[model samples]
Target: MARQPVARQTVARQVVASPVLVGRDEFLALAGRRLEDAATGRGHLLFVAGEAGIGKTRLVTSISRRAERLEFAVLRAAAFPGDAEATGGVLLDLAGDLRRAADAGWRDVGHALSARLRDPLAAQGDPHRQRRLLVQDLADLLCDLDPGRLLLVVLEDLHWADQLSLEVIGRVAVRLPGRATLMIGAYRSDELFPRTAMRQVRGRLLSQRVAEEIRLPRLTAAQTATLAGAVLGRRPTGSEVAAIHGRSDGIPLHVEELLAASGVPDTLADAVLVRARALDPGVRDIAAAAAVIGRSFDFDLLTAVAQDAPETVDRCLRELQSVYLVQAGADAATFDFRHALIRDALYADIALPRRRQLHERVARVAVERGYRDEFVSAHFDEAHLPGPAYWHALLAAREAAAASSHREALPLYRRAVRNLPDGSSPDFHATLLAALGAEAAAVDENAAAAEAYEEA
Candidate 1:
């Protein structure tokens, strides 16, 4: 399930009204032309990708207003967390928009869409078969919005859409038949990680030329200053622009928030926190545990450290993925946060005692899996388990030296020396010093090599 949408709004209320669109003249013009083409029976799917707060919504809104002015029936909906047929009900929502329009063709199209999508239990057979039937039903209804008539369907926050919704939407995008309907979706570009469902679909669309996506980058420094000036109703001073630009990192939403509050507003983490807190308790707890493992983690390690069944962890992770908090990584077995900011926020939100416990668990699991000694050593050290920490430090140093990474080995060797467990044998200490001396010499630090030899 996707997260609950804020509230459904009419197309006019949802996107007809937007503030100035900065840094998008060329795309806006291109979209204007696309609208003309769409109205004339050549229609296609379009997409917008950007980081959160980078003005994706604003860009879509600008296009939606133009689409409306050209007599295109504008319909807007967002994918959110909940049962698709219950809370979100995006298909039904669109149907409602159609009914409100009350045109003969549109009203019939709306009724057909509602009949197929509004019920989760009625006439339920094979889920796969039902989904196929729904796709066919949706495709058949497209002509009602085509040829002499047109519709612009704007779907936002697609990064939060569930798998079933994604599949249905993709099929709809593909089967439009170059008629008079344009389907445009907005998703966080950061959500497009390797092997993730969204990434796979996006890649397929682009590769097959089934859709065209516009990626919106952060505002340039000059553009950021311009935006600040507009919000301020006067030109911002050099220092004011610099401060806002630096802190906002050129994300338009951050810029708007900074200008609105005239300060940093305490923490942008608030938004992350609010979303995290709204998650199911079990999922939220797992997210915190994942954070303890850092911004990037694999499914196996997370499952082991999370102490849950693999299927359970996968379910929770899917929920996390749908919300754009964590994304699938280079392969299906790996995952990472959409941004370091998200990971840092979750990590900081964990209590210190719980954090230590998770670190200890992570170290234990890593050791069982024979993970890199440096990784194991860091976690053990964080858990304050000096005995194990010292042991892995020595192992890490030896491994680094074997890999011919003497510079990295030096610190590992020093860490081992500093954290040596009590009651160590004299010969053991001497051997450690000799190994350190060799690595130090390998790096051409003759002075340090002599000091280690003398210690030995």
Candidate 2:
């Protein structure tokens, strides 16, 4: 067989910059024009939304840099995960910058936060007064700092915004048109649902006509190829480019991982496996289990698989979330892989025994939870252990039959038959053959489903 050509090894780190702006020249140009308009005293509120890693932050950073050249006063705030010391962390950060711009005279802002707001309620004079005071303080600071110039206030990752921050942001959105302010807020669209803080803030902004939302779509295949070339410093081969696009679903961060892992010895899968192996053992183990269970595993399941104490698992989970390696589900107490490539790399690194042990645990837990036999069988098949493999195939066939997917089930039964011991009963062989024949006959061979079944 002919060897595949190596992807051009550019001496560059994969560009996983925030707001990874790629192939959206027209959109970016339009955004720049809006910022320019805002800088020229025609301020507008622009809300940018997309899935995580779609480049919202990168786009905003680019705009901020351009706004700087235009002489607009730029202020920024980023939301934090939990109860960090800084309650209004974003506001405090912006206030710090504003104070600096004002020759550090408004040091009172920092003093009030550090001294008076020692408790979450103390900052406001009381809990009920907190929201109103925060808004007033922010508005006052903005008005004070810029006196007459256009101001751009960007709040990134508002999906994690505290209630106080969201309320304050809503107020700012309502009040921006009258002021020389252009406030841009960016968040993950998949995370926006009714009744959540983000959704509520968005609703308030829309009702006030103070916000214009821009939904950032994934990069096109050509754009992705171009981005890969730019990052790699040379064009990728057709197959390598396709692999990057397909695996990343056009998400820039994922595309970077796929491209960066391309030239390592072994297949892409092996490369992922190798990288995964280099992680700390605890993280690596949890990551492997996450991959096997597929995206979005329950905390309870992780606990069972890792077989660690509750506190240990909790600490590990926090570490994962902190690094953006995993994200919590919006509605459920579940965690999902941060990126598809992470899962791919993890599974590639998993050894047979470890995979089998984890899968066995999965099979037991899933069965106890009343999950379908097919899911359980998938775990068993992935386990690749001896006695369980045959049982898994039978169960797979049974479940697939009920779902009208016998065409998909035929291969499992055939594999089971081939793997049966030499002393197996004649009746077992006949039963397996019969199941395969029936499955083959039920579907038209020309159909795509049939083709997949045939290949399997």
Candidate 3:
């Protein structure tokens, strides 16, 4: 018995809210202009690459909207995760558009495809064969029904695309000459490492010189501030602007998250911390470790703190990169938390005991390596141990002060003052008082300097 066809919803709903169109004006202009040119028979190919959540989709959406206004036909497809659709899936998507445009019911198209491909079940074959026939049908239909209409095809998240889809795209790329066609693809460069299938497709595209690649760099400080202001509906104070820029490092997605988290009364740091606490445990841990280690961290250090097998850590890192919580470094040897705010958020998420343990390990590693005393002291301050911990921490602060890193020394001195046992020796008290005075003087805080001297 022939089964009934499952009803499928074809409505195209907008998933993104009002996006604050930050940065990337130049790139957007170039893409828009090229697409416009393509509609006039100057066909070109564009490849937009960036890290995940770096606004590739948003940019492309803007271009697509503009193209529609200019009367150009736009076709879009996105790759899926595991259970990736084969090449036929992309072809099927293209074919559906062709069928719709012809005003020919799918049934008629299916009959035509089955007759053309010489398959009895051409209308109801497995998705793969259906896709193959669909593509063939689509190409023929395009030629038959409006061959002169400009068509702009966009494939997004190509990193997740299946091998067959990539091959299909390669075939389309080779056949684009003299046709009213422009193909645009977007993918995350960090995840598309050498030797992968995606990389192979990229290599073919390059060798053909049919693709023009545009790599989006991180946002500038001014651009970040402008974006934050737009998101918040007000100008950011100097401190707030600096805080967001420092932490977010100009990633549009991070900037948006930070603004949403900041709310009306809370500062940027507080907002970042709040958001960080809400992430999944694995992401939060990786973020925290990255923050403690600074902008970039070694994988070995992360594994040491997480106490997980290498593969487990690698998996977590990849997840972090996927959501833009972290980024892999250029050489692929190090990983970085995208923004300082993310790091702070992650740091605040961990259990106190685990944080202390991680800090202790970091401190021990620094001490064993004869690293700068100040760096070691910073870890001790983080560890929050007692007795000898306090003394070693104090020594680290003094070293920092000697190195003229008064800002770094200030927290250490403050911690020592707060944690020192009561009724301590006068000499120890006097030394701390003097160190605090010196730190204040270095920062030109005369009033605080005088107060420290008075305490001494």
Clash list (residue pairs), candidate 3: 87-165
User: After superposition, which runs of candidate 1 have C-alpha atoms over 4 Å from their true positions?
Assistant: 1-19, 82-88, 119-128, 193-196, 264-456
Q: What C-alpha lDDT values do all the predictions have?
A: 0.72, 0.62, 0.64
- Count of residue pairs whose backbone atoms collide, per candidate: 4, 3, 1
Candidate 3 residue-wise lDDT, 109-220, digit = tens: 5445334423323456664465565455545543342366877888877776545456557766666666677788988888775433467788888877877788988888
Report the C-alpha lDDT of model 1 over 1-456, residue by residue, as the tens digit: 233223221111111111567899988887887788777777788889999878777788889988888888787766532211121245655676677664777778788777755443243576445545655566566545664667888887676554445556777777664678888888888865543345666788889888898988888889988887777668888888888788788987667645544244445575566567767777887898899887678899998898887877888888777666788863568787765566888999998898999999999999999876777887887787889989998887775564344545776787788788889999999999888898779757789899999999
Worst 10 residues of 2 by lDDT: 1-10
Estimated TM-score per prediction?
A: 0.53, 0.54, 0.49
- Global local distance difference test of model 3: 0.64
Q: How good is model 2 by TM-score? A: 0.54
Residue 259 of model 1, lDDT score: 59
Q: Which stretches of candidate 3 lie over 4 Å from their true place?
A: 1-20, 83-89, 92-146, 263-456
Q: Compare candidates 1 and 3 on TM-score and give the better one.
A: 1
Poorest stretch of ten by lDDT in candidate 3: 9-18
